[model samples]
Target: VREEAISRSRCFLNSAMAFTLYTYPNNYRAIKSLIAAEYTGLEIVVPDEFKFPGDVRSEAFKAKSPVQKVPVLETPDGCLFESNAILRHVARYRPEANLYGGPFYEQGLVDQWLDFSAFELEPPRNVWLYPILGYMKYDKRAAGKARNDVEKALTVLEDHLLLRTFIVGERITLADIALGSALIAPFEKVFDAKFREKFTNVTRWFTTLINQPEWKAIVPSVSLCEKEQIPAFPKKKEKQPKQQKQKQQKSQAKKADDESAPPPKKKEKNPLDLLPKSEMDLDTTKRTFSNNPFPAALKIFYDAWDPEGFCLYTSSYNYNSENTVDYQTSNLVSGWLQRLDSLRKYAFGCVNVWGVEDSKGPFVINAAWVFRGPSVPFEFTDCPDSEYHQLASVDLKDEAQKAKFEALLGGAEKYDGQPLYERKQFK
Candidate 1:
C-alpha cells in the first residue's frame, strides 16, 4: 500500500513540477499553503505524520531543503522548504489568480507583509500560545516570554488595523493569507471578549478577511470562543475581615519558612511499585476473555508500559481464519516487543496508546497509540507494528542506557508482564 502511494506520487514529478506540501493539519504555515493552493487551483498533498526536522534528521530531506521545515514545496526545478516561499511560488504561477495583487509593487507589498507575518508575528504567537495550549513543549520561562511577545505583537496589529481594511493591500492578497493564519491562533486561543473589544478595529478586520470565500476554502472556519473581556491581572477586591487578614498573615509566614528550609530527599520505592496496583476483582461472567489471552495482555501492556516518546497502534485479530489471526497477532506481538526492546535504551518516560475500532463489525479493534513527551504529543500512527519498530532508532541513541532499560523490562522480578515506561529529562 505504501509503495503504491509512493508510485502514484511519482506521477506528479512529471507534471508542471508537482507541488507536494509536507504539513500537519493544525500547522499555521501548512494552512497558509493550503489557502494559497486553493486560490491558485493547485493540488498539494500532505504527509500523514509530520516529524519535527530535528526528530527525523533525514539527510535526503535536509539536502533538498536546508531549513528542513514542513510545508515543503517540491518542484521539478527545486524543493522549497519554508511556508512563505511555497506560497510565493504558487502565487507567481497564477498571476491572474489575484491572490498576490495586480501591480508588481502591490505584489512586493504583499510579500513584505508575508515576511512580517512569519518573522514578526507567527514566531512570538507560537512561542507564547503553542506551549500554553499544549501544542508544543517549552519551559515556563520560555513560555512566559512567548506570551509577552505575542501580546506586544497583538497590540501592534490592533494599532495597524485601526483604519486599514487589510494588512497590505485593499484586496485580500498573500499578506492576508500569511498574516491571517498567524492571527487565527490568537483569535482562537488567546484573545478574550475584552481583548477583542479593546481592539475593535483588529477584530473587525480579522472577521471580514477570514470570512471571505477564498480564505474560507482553505481555513474553513477559525475556531473561536465567545469574545471575553480581558480581566485585570491579580484582580482587585474589597478588604477582607480582620480575622481573615490575620489568618492570611499566618499562612504567609508558614510559606516563607517552607521556602527557606532545605528540601527533603525522597526515598525511591521498590521497583515493584512501578507496576499497576492489582486489578479490582470483576465478575468474569460479564466479560470473559473470548479471544486469545495474548490480545488482552497486549492491550494491557500498551495501556500500562507505553513508551514515553513514540506513537502506537493496536492490531485487529480474526479468530476464524488462521492466516489472518496469525499474521495479525504476530505483527502485533512483534511490534510490542520491538517497542519494549527499544525503550530499554534511550528511555523516555511514558507512552500513550489509543484504541481504534473496526469501521463496521462485531470485531472490536484494540489498536492505536500516540507517543507524547512530557510536554507535547509528538508522534501518531495507525500501524502498531511500524511504531513499535521505530523505537529501535531511539534505543540506538544510547547503548548503555538502553541496556539498563532492557534489564528493567526483562527482569521478571520487576516488570513481569507490565509495560515499563519512563520520562525524559527536562532542562
Candidate 2:
C-alpha cells in the first residue's frame, strides 16, 4: 500500500511540477540536469527560443542566476543556479530513481564525487576545452597545464573504476552523471585513441554510461576522439584584391613545385649527442640496477659516476595532500615516468610514494634522477607533472643528501618516517 501511494505521489509531482531549464542548446553542464530529469520522469521545459547571451543577460533572468549563467532551473517556489545544484534538485522530485542513491551514506558518497567532479575535473576541463571550441582565447602554456590536470583527474577516476562498474554503489548515481557529463566534451574533443588506451576501466565505464537510454535521450550522440584537436587561431578576413593576388601566387608556387622536387629535409640530431663523452655507462648501470641488489647497484653507480658530465637531482610532488588512494598515487608516478619516455637514454631514477591508501594517506611522492648533462634535461622538465614537482639539485658531497638519494633509488622500507608504498623506476 505504501509503495503504491509513493508511486501515485510521484506521478502527481511529475505532472504538477514542471521546471524551466533556461539555457542555450547543447550546453554539456545543462545536460546533467536533463539526464537526471529523464531518470526521475520529470517534465523539464527547455525554452526553444532561448537566446543565449541576450536572454541570459536580461534583468528578468537576473533572479534565476546571480551571474546570469545559463542552466538556471526555475521551480514553482524559487529558482536555482549552478548546474550541479540544479541536477540535485531535479533528482529529488522522484525518490524511486535512486539517482542520488537510496541510503543516506550512499547519498553522501554521491556528494563527495560531485564535489570531486566540480573541483578536480571541471576547472581544468574548461580551460583545456573552451579554447579549442573558440569560447576562450588560446594560451599554449595554460592549455598544456590544463591537459595534464585533466589526465591526472582521469587517472584518479581510472583507478577508482577498476574495481566497480559505477562510481558509488551498484546502480548509477548522481556522481556518475556529474563526472560523466564533465568528461563528455573531453572524450569527444581531446581524449584521442592513444590517450584513452591508458585508462581502459574509465573508458569502459564511460562508454557504458553515455550509451544508456536516459543519457542518449539528452546527449543524442557521442563520437570518441580520433585525432587530437590542437588549439587553432581563427583566420583573419582577407581583402578581395589580396585573395585574388594570393590565388595567382599560389598558382605560380604550384607550377614551380611541379617543375622540381624539393630537397630532402635533414634530420636534426639530439642536443645530448653534441656533449663530450663521459665514462659513466648508463646502459651498464641500468643493467646493474636491474640484475644486482640495491647495495651492489649503488656501488656500481658511485664508481662510474661523473659529476661534471652527469647531474643528480631530486623531485617531489607539491600536491601530495590530494592523493587518497594507493593505485591512484601509484598511477600518478607511473604517468610521470611514461611522459619521460623520450628521456629514457638520457635519464634514470626511482620515484617512491610514501604512506598507505585511505588510512594515513594522501601519499607523498618523491624521486631522484640522474641526467646525462650537468643540468636537468628539458625533456624531464617538460613532462606533464613537471609543474607540480619541487625540483632540486642533489649534492652528493653532503652525506645526508647522498643517503637520501640512496634511500630513494634503493627503495628503502621507509621515507621521512612514513612507510614506502611503492617505487617506480624510469630506467
Candidate 3:
C-alpha cells in the first residue's frame, strides 16, 4: 500500500506524462518505442485506431509527422516521427534510464549498429519479407537478390554476435532494440531450421533477445520459419477436357497469386494539406478531404487510420495448427465470412493468408473493420471464443471519416486475400 501510494505521487508530479504512439503491431519499426518505454518506465498509449486507415495520413497526423511515417511519438514537447528518432527521444526521456550507451565511444558503437540495423538490415529484410506477406508483389528475381542481400547483413551480425552477448556492450542498447525488431518478420517468415543451423552465433544472440522480459512484453511469440515458402501454385492432376483443364489451372493460379499478394507500394506523401476547416477540431470531425487525389495504391496502402464507428479485429484458427491441411485453412476463412452474414451493414474487411495455402503451415484471420456503434458487440468478439485465436478492436478514423470509410472499403485491395479463399461480400 505504501509503495503504491508513492508511485502514484511520483506520477502526479511528472505533469501527467502520457504518450500516444500512432501505428500498428507486429511492426518492427514500432518496437523501439515500445521497448524503450519499458526501460524508461514511461507511460505510452497506442490509440486503438491504428488497426484502421488514415491515422498517419490525416491532416492532423501529418501536421505532427510531416513525412507521415509511423511510430510517431506524441510528446508534451511535440510530435516526433521516425522510429530511430523516437527511440532516441524516449531513451533520453528520463536521464536515469541508461538505454543510450555510456561514454563517447560506446555511444558511437550504438550509432554504428543503429545505422547497420536500419540501412544494412531493414531494406533487404523488407524486400525479402514484404513479398512473402503479400505486402508487395512477389517478383522472383527481386526476391532472390533480396535474399542474397539479407545473407550479407546476417554475416556481419554473425561475426559481431560471435563475440558479444548483446549487440553492444553489457546492457541492451538501441542497436539491439533496432536490430532485434527488424529481424522479427524475417525470422518468422523465412529463416528456417537449416538457415539457423548455419548461423549458430546469430541464433544464440536471437535467443537472448527473444527471451528478455522487455522483449517478450512487446512480442508475445517468436517462431522461426520452419521452411522457406514459395507462393506459386502446383500442377493439377484431375481429369477434365484439355481446354477446361487449362482454363481451370490458369484461374486457380491467378487466384492464388491475388490472395497471396500485399499492397503494391508505399505512399509516403500525405495527399492533403488543410483538411476542410471545420469549427470542430480533428478529434470530432467526420469528413476530411485529402489535399490531393488518393491513387488506388495509396488508398490501398495508406487507407487505414482508425475510423469512427469501427474497430480493427484479428483472429487466428483456434485449433491445433499442426492439424491444418492445405486449402482447409482458406476454407476456414470462407466459412467465417459466410458466418459473418449479419455484419454486412456494419463491417467491411478482408481475410488474409500469410503463407501459401498448400504449403504455408498456419493461417491467421485478420479483419480491419468498423461497427455501426461506438464499440463492437461482445457477440462478434467473444461469443465463439474457441473458434478464434484472437479477436480485438484496435482503432482508426477520419480526415475524419472519409479516409476511414475508404480504408474499410479498400481492405480487399490491401490484403487482397480473395484468391486464397472464396471472397465473400456481405454487402
Q: 326-373, model 3: which lDDT tens digit per residue?
A: 344444455556656655544445445544444434443444444444
Q: What residue runs in model 1 are displaced by over 4 Å at the alpha carbon?
A: 1-18, 49-55, 135-145, 227-427
* C-alpha lDDT score of every prediction, in listed order: 0.53, 0.83, 0.62
User: Number of clashing pairs, model 2?
Assistant: 0
Off by over 4 Å in 3: 1-15, 232-239, 242-427
lDDT-based ranking: 2, 3, 1
Per-residue lDDT of model 2, residues 1-427, tens digit only:
5346446755876778678889887787898889888787777899888898777657788767765666889999899987888998888877677888878999999999998997678767887888788765566666787788788989999999999999999989899999998889889988999999999999999999998998999987899999988778779987579779999999999998888877789998888878998898887878889899898888888988898789998888866755655655665677677777889989888889999654537689998888898898888878755766878888988988888888888648898788888887889
Deviating ranges (above 4 Å) for candidate 2:
1-10, 234-427
Which is the better candidate, 1 or 2, if ranked by lDDT? Answer: 2
Q: Candidate 3, after superposition: displacement of residue 78 in Å?
A: 0.5
Rank all candidate structures by their TM-score, best first, as comma-separated numbers. 2, 3, 1
lDDT tens digits, residues 225-327, model 1? 4653222344579999999999999999999887877778899753333444333211221122222253453354435443443323222232211111212
